[model samples]
Target: MKKVLIVGAHGATAQIVTARLLAETDDQLVLYLRQSRRLAQYADNARVTLVDGDVSDIEKLTAAMAGVDVVYSNIGGVDLGTQTKHLLTAMQQAHQTRLIFMSALGAHHEVPGKFGDWNEQAIHDFLPGFREAAQLLATSKLDYTEVRPAWLTNTDEIDYETTTLADGFKGTEVSRASVADFMIKVIADPSLYRRESIGLDKPGTDGDQPSWL
Candidate 1:
C-alpha cells in the first residue's frame, strides 16, 4: 500500500484530501500538524497516524516521514518557502521523492486581465514568498507537482479545469474539493504532472474576476 504523508493536515483543502484518500485508496496516511489535538477525530483510524510537530523543524519532519512514499503539503503563509525548504530537506534525508504541493494560482504571474490584477493586489504581500517556493520546487530534481489553485470556495462541487504552466491560467474560482480531487488524482498517478506546475479553476467560469469578488 502507498504511504502518504500530509503536511498541514488540518487545512480546509487537506481535510477533503484526507477523506478522499481514506475512502478511495488502500493507503497508509500520516497526518502531520503542529498540534495532535487538531486531529483527534482521526486518532482511532487504523490507517491514519497523527504526527505533531512544526514543518520548519527538519528533525521532527524527518522523523515523521519514515516509510512515507509520497508527501502532500497543504500549508501556506509567509513562511511557506522556509517550510518547503525544511520539507525538501527532510524528504531528501528520508529518501522520499514524490511531492504534491498546494500553491496559489498567481504564484507564476500567469493569471490574466482585471482578475489577475486584483489577485496580485490582494496577495502582494504574500506572493513573493510563494513564487520563491514555486521556483525552488520547479528547479529541484525531485518528483514534484505544484498545484496552483485559483480562488477557492467551500462548495462541494468537483467541476474543475486545468492549465499547464505553458498554456497560462484560466477562470477565477474553483471549489476546494475540486483542488483536492486534482491532488488525489496526481497522487494515484505519479506520472501525471511530474516536475510541472499547473493551475486549477472551474471550467466556464473565466471572467475579469472571480464571481465572488
Candidate 2:
C-alpha cells in the first residue's frame, strides 16, 4: 500500500479526501495537522497516523514524510507562501517529490470576466500568498499539481471539469467532492496533471458569481 502524507488533514476537503482514501484504497495515511485532536474520530483507524505540527516546523514535518509516496497539502492563510516554502524544505529533506497542493481559483489572475472581478474583490487579501505559493511550485523541481478550485461548495455531487494554467478558469463554484475526486484521481495516477496548475470547476456553472450570493 502507498503511504500518503496529508498536511492540513483537518480541512473540510481534506476530510473527504482522507475518507475516500481510507475506503477506496489500501493506502496508509500520515495525517499532519496543527491540532491532532481534531481527527480523534480516526484514532481507531489502523490506516491513519495523526501528527500534530505546523508546516513551519520543518523537523516534525520532515519526519512525518518518511516513506510517503505522495503528499496532499490542503492549507491556507496569510502566511501560506511561507508555509509552502517550509513544506518544500521538509519534503526535500525527506527525499519525496510528488505533491498535490490546494490553491484558489484566482491565484494567477487566471479567472475571466465579471466572475473574475468578483472573485478578486472577495479574496484580494489572500491572493498574494496564493500566487506566491503557486509560483513557488511552478518553478520547483517537484512533480506538483496546484489545485485551484472555483469557489467551493458543500454540495454532495462530484461533477467538475478542469482548466490549465494557460486557460481561463470557468464556473462559479464546484463541490468539495469534485475537488477531492480530482485529487484522488491524481493520487491513483501521479502522471495525470504533472507539473500543472489546474483549475477545477463544475461545467456550465459559470456566472457573475456563485449562486448562493
Candidate 2's displacement at residue 189, Å, is 1.0
User: Any idea how many clashes model 2 has?
Assistant: 0
Off by over 4 Å in 2: none
Worst 10 residues of 1 by lDDT: 204-213
TM-score of each: 0.97, 0.98
lDDT of each: 0.90, 0.94
| Top-TM-score structure, candidate number | 2
The residue-by-residue lDDT of candidate 2 on 51-132, one tens digit each, is: 9999989999999999999999999998899999999999899999999999998889989999999989999899999999
Evaluate residue 113 in candidate 1 and report its C-alpha lDDT on the 0 to 100 scale. 85
Off by over 4 Å in 1: none
For candidate 2, the per-residue lDDT at 14 reads 97
lDDT of 1 by residue, 1-213 (tens): 788999999999999999999999998999999888988999999999999988888988899889888899998898788878888899889888899999998899898888889999988988987998998898887899999988999997999988998999998899999999998998888889889898998998888877876
